[model samples]
Target: MSPARGGWVILLSVVLAMLLSVVQLPQGTPDWLAWLRPNWLLLVVFYWVMALPHRLGLITAWLIGLFADVLHGEALGVNAFGLAGITYVTWSLYERLRMYTRAQQALLVLVLATLLELVLLAAQLVTLGLSFEWMGLVQTLVTAVMTALFWPPVFLVLRWLRRHLKVV
Candidate 1:
């Protein structure tokens, strides 16, 4: 039998992720708090790729990252390259990742998100001659913390959507 499909749901999730990537904070928000903002697009892409590897993989991540690069007004392909790495790592380990407990998975997310930040930072340094800031590390830590905190709910919801839509 053929695997089920949920193309529209996947598209909708990706669009929402892109929108979240471009969302602005309130004017009075502190710089530290702003830095705590999670990488929503990365999280969404990770979730979908983990849950549906056969359906979503490197190309989807690269395209989503490209759109995000445009939305964030960053160097084109920065996010694409970073997300492609995430997809590769995730694709390689999807089976083990699925078998992991939530806490273990969150730890993995932390590592992956940190790697993504490092890749982007490295790219920026190469092309823009940007100096490293301690804040960048802090931001990476916060992104991981947020990803860990958010993963359970997001996973549950996506799993529900997949089951409801009969996506294989």
Candidate 2:
């Protein structure tokens, strides 16, 4: 595929991921259940960075993170910083990431997600001066587990998309 077409396809996927990220849970859902929400944008970004490291890098991640910040109504640059951090790590390790088994990749995803959450929390602490909540750690663990569980399907589907669409 032409680079332009491939770039658009990747951007569309990122946009969809952003939409998924902001989707609201049903009313009256338990708080714990809410904490289990996966960071869809991060998962999608991870896939693209792994799949097409040349095309999707820190800039793509930063842009998506800015959009996520707006979509989720968080402080500007919070998600940008966290997502950029993850993307950088993914890009640096793309070859190794691709070689790993799915299960191993999931563990890496969990670690990356935890780090992302910590970055966001630290940003909140600095910007909003919000006292740290221990519950935030639980939320991070829940999000990590959910991200790990969701990774295989996401990886497969994105792999299919890359193949079928001929995304370079």
Write candidate 1's Cα lDDT for 1-168 as tens digits. 685577889889889877776678888878677666777777788888888888887888898889888888779999998898889998999998999998888888888887887777677677888788887667677776786677777788888988898777
Q: What TM-score do all the candidates reach, one by one?
A: 0.89, 0.90
Give candidate 1's error at residue 121 in angstroms: 2.0
lDDT of 1 at 149: 75
For candidate 2, give the lDDT of residue 39.
86
Candidate 1 global Cα RMSD = 1.8
User: In model 2, what lDDT does residue 98 have?
Assistant: 89
How does residue 140 of candidate 2 score in lDDT?
Answer: 72
In model 2, which runs have C-alpha deviations exceeding 4 angstroms?
A: 1-4, 28-31
User: How much lDDT does each candidate structure score?
Assistant: 0.82, 0.85
Q: Compared with the true structure, what per-residue lDDT tens digits does model 2 show for residues 1-168?
A: 454456777888888888787777888987667677788888999999998888887987898899888887779988998889989999999999889999999999999988887777777677887888888777777887898889999999989988898888
